[model samples]
Target: MKAIVVVGASLAGLRGAEALRQQGFDGTLTMIGAEPHLPYDRPPLSKEVLRGTWEPEQASLVRGDNIDKLELDLRLGRRATSLDTGRRRVELDDGSAVSYDGLLIATGATPRRLPGTDGMEGVHTLRTLDDCLAIRAGLERGPRVAVVGAGFIGAEVAATCRQRGLDVTMIEMLPVPLEPAVGADVGEALAAVHRDEGVDLRLGVGVDAIEGDGRVEAVRLSDGSRVEADLVVVGVGVAPETGWLEGSGVKVDDGVACDARCATSVPGVVAAGDVASWHNRTFDETMRVEHWSNAAEQARAATSTLLAGDGGGDPFESVPFFWSDQYDLKIQSAGRLAGADASRIVSGSLETRRFLKLYGRGGRLVGALAVNEPRRLMVMRRQIRALPDFDEAVAAASDDGSA
Candidate 1:
């Protein structure tokens, strides 16, 4: 390939670009981004950046001599308008285009915005560095914060607000937080984490509207009640940033549909990060993961897949992994914990709020979730990969010293 291009100057994009260079691709490398900043760490934006532990600028993932020596054209603050797969070039919003022999789509995701809430002051969605900075400034005012959606982002934001001594209310349409991702039982267990921290959590309620004269002053709930709030932070979830590929013939089923190798339906165009969905040979299912770890791992896998033929690239097969921090609890999980028919605590107890829960489907170990139990979480990850019987996995996950 003479020229290579990557959309979405994302963390995954940076890693994929570096991997390509490291594999000795001395061609024209171009990185494009909608955001003005370089590829940076986003996991810290909600926690560290909000807590004043790090500045928004400090969240840049590519630091020091990492990307400086790559000699790639870094195109920041420009949106990729359309993809011309036939012409092998990406048209930009500025009416220019970048031609490439190979292209990687890593455009990640955008926070799902609330309906009729656009341009409303104090209405925030935490997706970018600027958003985090604005919210951090909002927190400094100690405003009564109403965080809509009690998923990972909402929970973290509520926790950070509570820590900052702000009046925080976390609302979820579901009966429990993260019910869609981590099942109901484990979700309720973690829900207690929020309650114990003094967060006013409203479960099983949908938002009617954001009410105010000119700024967000309250959130009308479905139950005919309203919570007084000076700010509203929406963390409902994110949708894949695939609008640019609408007519590009790249399969877009919820995301850019790829096979197990991260190769898009259109040849010479592969996708990674939140924008890519594929049948994972590991779990034997088609899924799109929106976690930081998944993005990094998939980018490396996509890079390998992109550099194949002349060089060998391994097919991507990974068990999904992600974690969250809230108050005094360190919640971690790996593998697919949602589809399991049966779940058991192999060691420790949820009553203590520090236990490892193993999930099984068809009597085979499929997933594990742990709270403040890193060692057992690691063991469970290995056992989940082993695909042992329920009894074997239970014994393996036990702290009895041997599997």
Candidate 2:
């Protein structure tokens, strides 16, 4: 029987093991997670978990019976210190090692820490369940909250702060929230939401330094402004957790380099989830995405390759899909709209915050972003996957039935 080792007990790692089992591979499954808890959904850490809407115990991704049925070897609360590709073993920080026949590197990224605040008391990040637990405890202390970096995580944290009726200030280096992911226009839409919710949305400025006598007391801005707050949540972003594999012979550029099948450069080793960057078939480019759907989709492909060498049918080029729940809106989008030639107002209106924006490149449907209209995006995803003729469909969809 083959022994499969999966590092990083994340959403992808858990799902990858399940996929291996589903593929009828009765192998020795060892899952290594740095965090002590079992695999749990992370997207909720910023929204529901932080807002006191979902308890930490309830945020678990894998339920009871799934692990026992799969017969997985769970290694919780232990960090894999390094990888030895030659010996096919993973070294743990506690001076132990686990050898494997097949390896899947799913160790997800960690929240980028603010320099000089590592051991600080109230500085927080929302990544693991322990981070959520610590931050939630601080939230109970009723400390004024300051969130750095206005990406999706920061925005969600600010929304949660408002939900909890805590005094919150969101600091961003960009002029608008979510500038890098969504364009300026879409980012402005999100910034407007925060403003309407009475959040202190400070844009175009970053933290000069976090200052306090002992614990976090205030955030000093680059613009020479000081905002007094008892707590600071740094949501700047996440960096891929690939440092442990430095000498493992696994190719690591921006992330673990892989082909369409999620195969690492090293034989007998595979990578998936946010840490894996491979040639994207749909866009015909090399890219790495740190999204929930991408992780789940890639894990299935990676596991299939490990078990039966199926390599997931074809090079995955489907438009990526991601959704975030903030307040009353469900924002959904498919495809890479970052570098589109032009975006046409498709089915919805941005003014009302309930519309869809279709992006085109060389006269083809490249991407679509919908706010509160998930069905439209679902149809748009099908069109993008099929690579349909944009002109004819736009003309035909005049009557709602075809689109």
Candidate 3:
């Protein structure tokens, strides 16, 4: 391919562009980013940046002389309006079209917003650098904060606000936070952690509306309860950015549907990151991972698939991994945790707030979660890739003196 275009110049897009060059594809590389800035690390936006421990520059993905060496036609602040498979062209919002011999769709996702919260001064979503900055500025006011969602992002923001000694009330519709992803037992344990840190945890409740005249003044719960707030941060989740590919014939379901090799329905076009939903051969399941690690790893794999031409590359098989930092705990997980048949804490205890829990599905050891148990979590992660029997894995863990 003589020319290539990479949409969504964030972590996945930046890494994919770099991989193309590393694989000896020295073509006219054009990177289109909706954001006005260069690709920057996102995980820190919720932690250090929101807490004022790190400046905005610290989140830069490529620093010093690194980005200069990529030789990229970096088009920032420009969104890809649509894609045309017939002409191999991408239409941008700036009234320009770029033809590509190969295309990398890394459009990622946009955060879900609560209705009637738009144009409200104190309502915020943490998805971008600007979003984080606005919330951080609100934090300076020491506002009474109501976080609507118990997901990782919401939890982190609440933890950050608490660290700053702000009154934080976290609302979740589910009785246990992250129960669907990590199981009820583990979710309860996490809830205890937040409570211990002085977070006003409101479970089994949904936000009915944001009550305010012009700025967010309070959150009305579904149970007819009101959480008086000066600022509201919504962390409900995100939806994949696939609207531009509707008529592009890329086969988008929850994301851009790709095969095991990361090749999309259209030849010469592949996807990665939050926007790409590909079949993972290792797990024997189709998934779209929104973690930072998956974005980087899958980008390289998707780029390889693109370079190898149609039906030429090896399958992109990987164990999903993600980490979340809240208070004094670093929660980490590997493989698929959701929809597991069973889970057992093989190390430590929940009362101690440090443990390693193994998850099994269909008689196979499929996932592992760790609370301050990184070493054991990685070992379990590797074992998960081998697809060992759940009972045998648990026995091995006991024999190895994990508990």
On TM-score, the leading prediction is 3
Instruction: Give the least accurate 10-residue stretch of model 2, judged by summed lDDT.
Output: 308-317
- Tens digits of per-residue lDDT for model 2 on 1-403? 3798999888999888988899888878898998888889988888888788888878888788887888988899888989998999999988999999889999888889988998888999888878887888899989899999888788788888888899999999998777656777888988898888888988999888999877888899999999999889999888899999988789998899998778888878888889999888877768888889999989988877776443433455557888887777788889877787766656656678887877767777777788998887888887787656656556544335355
Question: What lDDT does the true structure give each of the candidates?
Answer: 0.87, 0.83, 0.93
For model 2, the stretches where C-alpha displacement exceeds 4 angstroms are 309-314, 389-403
Estimate candidate 3's RMSD in Å: 1.1
lDDT of 3 by residue, 1-403 (tens): 8999999999999999999999999989999999998899999999999999999999999878777888999999999999999999999998999999999999999999999999999999999999999999999998999999999999999999999999999999999999999999989999999999999999999989999999888999999999999999999999999999988889998999999999999988999999999999998899999999999999999999999987888899999999999998999999999999988888788888788889999999999999998888888888899989998788777635643
Q: Per TM-score, what order, best first?
A: 3, 1, 2
Model 3 regions more than 4 Å off: 399-403
By lDDT, the better pick of 1 and 3 is: 3
Cα error of candidate 1 at position 32, Å: 0.3
> For every model shown, what is its TM-score relative to the native structure?
0.97, 0.95, 0.98
Return the number of clashes found in candidate 2.
2
